[model samples]
Target: MIRFERVSVRYEGTERPTLSGVDLTVPEGELVLLVGPSGVGKSTLLGTVSGLVPHFTGGLLSGRVTVGGRDTRTHKPRELADLVGTVGQDPLAHFVTDTVEDELAYGMESLGLAPDVMRRRVEETLDLLGLAELRDRPIATLSGGQRQRVAIGSVLTPHPKVLVLDEPTSALDPAAAEEVLAVLQRLVHDLGTTVLMAEHRLERVVQYADQVVLLPAPGAPPVMGPPAEVMRVSPVRPPVAELGLLAGWDPLPLSVRDARRGAGGLRERLADASPPEAASVPEPAAPPEASAMPGAPAPVVAARPRTGRFARLLGRGAVARAAPVADPVTRVDGLGVRRGRVEALRRVTLTVAPGETVALMGRNGAGKSTLLGALVGMIEPTAGSVRVGGLAPARTDPRAMVRRVGLVPQEPRDLLYADTVAAECAAADRDAGAAEGTCRALVSELLPGVGDDTHPRDLSEGQRLALALALVLTGRPPLLLLDEPTRGLDYAAKARLVGVLRGLAAEGHAIVLATHDVELAAELAHRVVILADGEVVADGPTGRVVVSSPAFAPQTAKILAPQEWLTVSQVRGALEAGA
Candidate 1:
């Protein structure tokens, strides 16, 4: 249904084209996944089909692009609205109305559909996306994941023949992501809708793709084929696919079930072997000796923190030891927070010790974000007490609060206001009283080689997130809180972040991350806390909590369960040791 013939696009002021000589075809009634590294024109390619390229984005387009035989060159986005429904990475920017129900219906109203038709479609979408309870909630009040579902439902209500989604499930919890993927499957199989989606979290969606389009690099021709064929040589791969490569399987298994069917031998080999040891918490460094100058009271110097295991192995020295593990960096007792008529958090009590990494997980609207907000002084508790670094967050001054805790919200854009990346980093360094290039250094470590002159708004979702995270880390707070921080990050980027966070943890920084990326939680978190309906339902070590819950388990854990393995690296390490 979508065809690109000799397509090449070059944005203004750029010497080379973003996409060069791309010839591709996506058949109707099929789901095609677009995969690539960050800023490799995945979004640009999707925009071409919806007639946003060259039309609204101010790019020069060459060659023909057609959707349902309608040349996008001739039809603007509004004209093709009935045929194409596009949902970008930022859902907040897509909404025209304030409430969930209104946002879902706005598209149909714009299409001038019959009121009855629009209403019926709205109800169907709400149920399909599990947004029924949130239908009446204001878009502003909804969580990031909830906003994503609403953005998707709003587009789905239009009943367009072609659907284009950018990181559709990035913000969703595992179960919620499955629901969205299932709905897309139904659309492709039962309704014959053409679905084109780009997601950094391939493990969540790779198994469902009917075909895969691999964009190797900028201006490079895209490779398209069956999922397995493309994944074999693709630079980016899912955990299961990586495992298949490691085990020398004839054909890589794209799903857990397939991997398990072929993993009996591998499982038996590992049955007696213990999983690799978790990253060790380093011992505290000794304090510096007092200054020896006569009459000068010894000037006390703080010791450095230790880095995480991965960082040490990689020789990055990203982490260091900061304080004794017994010291509590954050404490909450009988904490309760209410927003409007909703009790966002109820008597929630948790403690994060120095150098500990904790993950707060739950379905959409499950109070994770609200809890993070409270820790950062963004949300005041209605009852109970909360303290970070020996001070109440709500009562602490902004300057002091920043030193105690820093939060990277689900919407990274909220923390960014500068016109360019350079200015933003410079401002962050100044605000945090950090070294001149501290923020820029963090950004380079997180997202390397990005131009300083680039506007923050022009960056991909992942890039923006890295920038925001750098801004926060520049303050070097004792406690760090991240809300759905992995939304748009590819595996390589995630690995880099894992090292960075591990290093921070080693340095005696306590971290509480509210996330939906189970793989991330399995790899980085020491403990997992599950919340539902504003209450903590499950709290325990990462191994027990994630392995016991099928919805929260990582791919490797699912395949090698009964064995307590949570990552492909763990399995690989065991094999290498035995060999």
Candidate 2:
């Protein structure tokens, strides 16, 4: 139903084309996935199908693109709106209405559908996406994951023949992501709707795709095939696929179950090996160096605090947290928060010590981000106390708090304000009271390719995250908080972040990460804290906490059951040791 004939796109500023000779066809009633490294033009490629490329973005387009038998070059986005529905990376940018119900119906109303039809579709969507309970909530009030579902529901109500989604599940929790992917499955299987989506979290969505299109690198022609075939040559891959490659499986397994089914020999091979140890505090490093390539800047978007849905699924596995720490960097005791009538948090307590890493995990509205908000002084607790560096975070001075704690909120754009990457780095250095090149050095280490002149808005999801992290690290606060840190990062970018965080932990910094990325938790978090509906239901060591619940365990743990292995790196380490 979608065709690209020798298509290539180039934005005005860049030296290389965003897309080059991208010839491919997406069949009707099939779900096609776009996979690649960050800034490989996956988002730009999706824009062409909806005719938003040359028409709205002002990028030069050279190839013929057609959707539903209509030429996108001739038919502008507005003209093709009825035939195509798009949900970009940012959900807030997609909304045109205030409330969930209104947002869902807005698209249908634009198409001039009957009121009854719009209402019917709206109700169905709310139910399908588990948004029925939040129907009356304002778009401004929903979590990032919640807004993402609402955005998807809005486009879905229009019942377009094609759905072009960019990072559709990036903000969603595992359960919520599954629900969204299931909804897409139903749309493709039952309604004959076609879906073209690009997501960095392949572990969450790769198994569901009918076909995979890989953009190997920047400006490279895309490689297309069955999911497993493309994953073999693709640098971007899910943990299961990576595991399969390591095991020399004939066809790379796309799902955990597939790998698990063929793992008897592998399980025996790892029967006596132990998992790699988690990050430990390191000695202080020497002072910052002089020069390095510039890092990144990002768009402003704290307006949409990302929410996740896996909170409900979190209950599938639960354990109590570790013993309280003495002289903690931050502490929360029986904290409670209310957003209007919603009890966002209730009687929750968590503490992080110097040189420790803790992962705050739960589903959307599970109070993970809510707890982070309370710690960062963004949300005031109604019932309990929050102390950071011996000061009440909500009442502490902003300048004073900078030394106590720093937060890279779910929206990476929240901490960024400069026009260019270099400017952002310079500003970070000034605000943090650090050396001139402190922030830039860190940014370059985490993100190597971002140019100094690149605009924050022009950055890819991973690039923005790396930039935000660099900004926060510049402050050198005693405590650091990250909400969904890996939301937009690929495997390589994520590894770099892991290295950075591990180093920070080594440097006696306390880290609290609120995330839905199980693999990340497995790799970095020494402790896992699971919150469910505003309360801590599970807390313990990462290996113990994750293994207690089947749903929360990482891919390696699932495949190497009963052995308590949580990451492929652990298995790889063991194999290398034995070798």
- RMSD of candidates 1 onward, in order: 9.5, 8.1
lDDT by residue (tens digit), candidate 1, 169-217: 9999888899999999999999999999999899999999999999998
Candidates in order, TM-scores: namely 0.91, 0.92
Name the weakest run of 10 consecutive residues (lDDT summed) in model 2.
293-302
Looking at candidate 1, the ten consecutive residues that score lowest on lDDT are 293-302
lDDT of 1 at 531: 80
Q: What's model 2's overall lDDT?
A: 0.85
TM-score of 1: 0.91
lDDT of each: 0.86, 0.85
lDDT of 1 at 297: 29
For candidate 2, give the lDDT of residue 226: 92
lDDT of 1 at 85: 98
